[model samples]
Target: MMRWLITGGCGFMGSNFIRYWLKNHTEDYILNLDKLTYAGNPDNLKMIENHPHYRFVLGDITDPQAIESLVPEFDGIINFAAETHVDRSIAQPRDFILTDMVGTYNLLEAARFHQKKLIQISTDEVYGNCPSGQNTEQAPLLPGNPYSASKGGADLLCLAYHQTYKVDVMITRSCNCYGPYQYPEKLIPLFITNLLEGKKLPLYGDGSCIREWIYIQDYCSALDIVIQKGKTGEIYNISTGEGIPNLEVTRLILQEMGMSEDLIEMVDDRQGHDRRYSLDASQIRQLGWNPEYLFSMGLKETLQWYRHNENWWRKIKSGEYQQYYRQQYAQRHKKSTLER
Candidate 1:
């Protein structure tokens, strides 16, 4: 049996991967390690909590003792632990730098000591705003925000570790992921939950910015391939290859729910918003890992998940979300008012 460690296994992407891997890899076992932050909920993994092939440990990646002690217990490690919200990174750059960059360093050092095959799960934001041309694995990073910058730093850290210690490392920079179990703070979930609740939906900067979204399950599939067959010291881009404008996606979503554009509230745009993020993931595609979800089909399924899981989101929306969300959804929103 293949024993593995999954950091941030309860996060949106992590949980998706964990669920898929556990169900599909009957002979494999996983140990989920998570800090259970505001965005990470243990409820995501409740279904498989009792599975013989799965176990969980609550821990932070920054804790040296914890990471070192557990590094040797697994055949592979996928790091999904990150402070991922861009808007929050603007207000709390230090925190983003801490978890995304510093925390990765902790994981890398521990993995090196244990000679573990480490897959550093990263974001396309590390490549910064993609220019007119499609970005490949070699694109030079030009991150604009603390969030992207931190992820970029972490990518470089992985490269450094590979160069210095010769640690077996595989880095995967995936585009946006949306699917079940995602916290309601992200775009698809946030607006879906708001639209369901009859609250005004906030769009950042006319919502014209574009991003390529890979369904969470497809991303999990890609990661699974990378873990099992990827070469060490290689970078793989995982994306749908087409960037969709935020407004178009939002409008489509609202239209699907029988809502109108009139329900949208035009708030201020986000600071340093990247106009577009596109990736050329042909490298992964050529490796026999093709994505299986279409935009409309994936979106419909994701929308339906939120629709079906109202209780899961309603609980989150009633607290901090009640206060910070409407404005945080758009960078143009002034916190001074939300604070009141």
Candidate 2:
């Protein structure tokens, strides 16, 4: 059985990947290492916590010694650990640089020393805005925000390790992912959870900024394919090619929740927010991978999940979430109210 170490396995995409891996690749063994940041909710993988082939390690990738000790135990490493939220990055770029870039460097070193294959989970934002056409893996890196810049730096480090040390490494840059267990800080879940809590949805700017959406399950499937079949030292883009405007997405969520557009409260635009992001996922598709859920169907499924798991998110939104929400939106709310 192939043994793998999956970093950041408590976060949204990472946890989904763990569940997907355990379910589909029954013969493989997994070791999940996570620092359990605010977004890394253990409850996301509570269902499989006791599985025989799965193990969880509380640790940080930024610690070289920690990574060194674990590197020898696993045949491969899939790094999903990152400071992902754009707003959080803007507010605290230091954490983003330290985690996304420096942490990745430590992992790369461990992987190189152990001669283990490495897979870097990345985002399409590294290409900045694609106003005209979809970006291929060959596109130049032009990260707009601190979060994307950090990730871009990490991606470059991974490729450099492969080229310089012959360390087996592959990278997959994917579009926005949404589904169950996602932390509510992101747009879709934020809107869904806010509506559930009798709060208004915070719509940014004119809400014309566009993003491609991929269901979490489909994203996990694509990652699985890459881990098993992808060649080392290559980069792949994973996308469904479904670009939708932020306002339109918020409206869809409102519609799904049977709420009114009147609930939307337009807020100040985010700093350095990319206009649009698109990815040419044809490369990964060529490796016998395709998304199973359309945006509409996936979104409906997501809404249903939130409806059924109200208690799960309700508890989260009660404490720290309240403080974060106020800090992020209070000023924008004031401005919006004045304009109205």
Candidate 3:
């Protein structure tokens, strides 16, 4: 059985991947290493916490020494640890640099030294705004913000390592992912949870910015296929090939939640927000993987999940997150004069 080390396994995408991995690959062993940042919630994987084939370790990937000691024990590594929130990245760029870039450098080093396979989880924002067409893996990296820049830097590092040291590394850059267990800071979950809580949906800018949305389950399957069939030293883009504007998405969320459009509160746009991010996922589709859930179905599933699990997101919106929300949005809220 293969033993894999999953970094940032407590975070939204990572945690969902672990649950997906364990359920599908019962024979494989997994060791989850996470720093347990505010976004990394252990409760996301509580159902499989006691599984014999899976274990959790509290650690940070930024520490080279810790990574060195851990890399030798696993057959391969999947680096998912990252500072992902764009607003937070804008507010605190250093954190994104440390976690997304430096942390990736450390993981690449360990993977190189140990000669182990590494799959770097990435985002489509690295391609910057794709206003006209879908970006293939050959697109140039023109990241618009601190978070994307850091991720883009790490992608370059992975390619560099492969060219210079022959490291077994592959990268997967996907579009926006939404589903159960996602931290409510992102657009979809934020709107869903906000509507549920009787709070206003803070619509950024004119809400005309467009993005492709993919269900987490579909993304997990794509990643699984990539791990099994993808060639080393290559980059793969995963997308649904559908881009929806922010306002339209907000309307869909409101409709799904049975809320009115009046709930949308115009807020200050994010600094350096990309207008669009589209990926040509045709490459991975050749590996016999296709998204099963359409945006409408996926959004409905996500809304139902939050509706059923009110306690989960409610706890997250309180305390520290509340302070963060106010700090991040309070000033921006001032610029808004529209409530509908």
The RMSD of every model to the true structure, in order and in angstroms, is 7.8, 8.9, 8.5
User: Best to worst by lDDT, what's the order?
Assistant: 2, 3, 1
C-alpha lDDT of candidate 3 relative to the true structure: 0.89
Error of 1 at 189 (Å): 0.3
Q: Give candidate 1's TM-score.
A: 0.93
TM-score of 2: 0.93
Q: How well does candidate 1 score on lDDT at residue 18?
A: 87
Off by over 4 Å in 1: 320-340
Residue clash pairs of candidate 3: none
Model 1 agreement with the true structure over 1-340: per-residue lDDT tens digits: 7888888887899988888998888998888877767887767877987787887777788788878877777887889999999999999898788888888999899888888888899989888887687889999988989999999999999998999999999999999999898888899998999999999889998888999999998998898888777889999999988589999988989889999899888899999999999999988887889889988889899998998988778867787543564224323321211010
List the global CA lDDT of all models: 0.85, 0.89, 0.89
Q: Model 2, clash count?
A: 0
Superposed on all Cα atoms, model 1 deviates from the true structure by an RMSD in Å of: 7.8
Candidate 2, which ten residues in sequence have the lowest lDDT sum? 331-340
Question: Which residue pairs clash within candidate 1?
Answer: 268-332
The per-residue C-alpha lDDT of model 1 at residue 119 equals 88
Give all TM-scores, in the order shown.
Answer: 0.93, 0.93, 0.93
Candidate 3 residue 68 C-alpha distance from true site, Å? 0.9
230-249: candidate 3 lDDT, tens digit per residue:
99998999999879999999
Could you tell which candidate, 1 or 2, scores higher by lDDT?
2
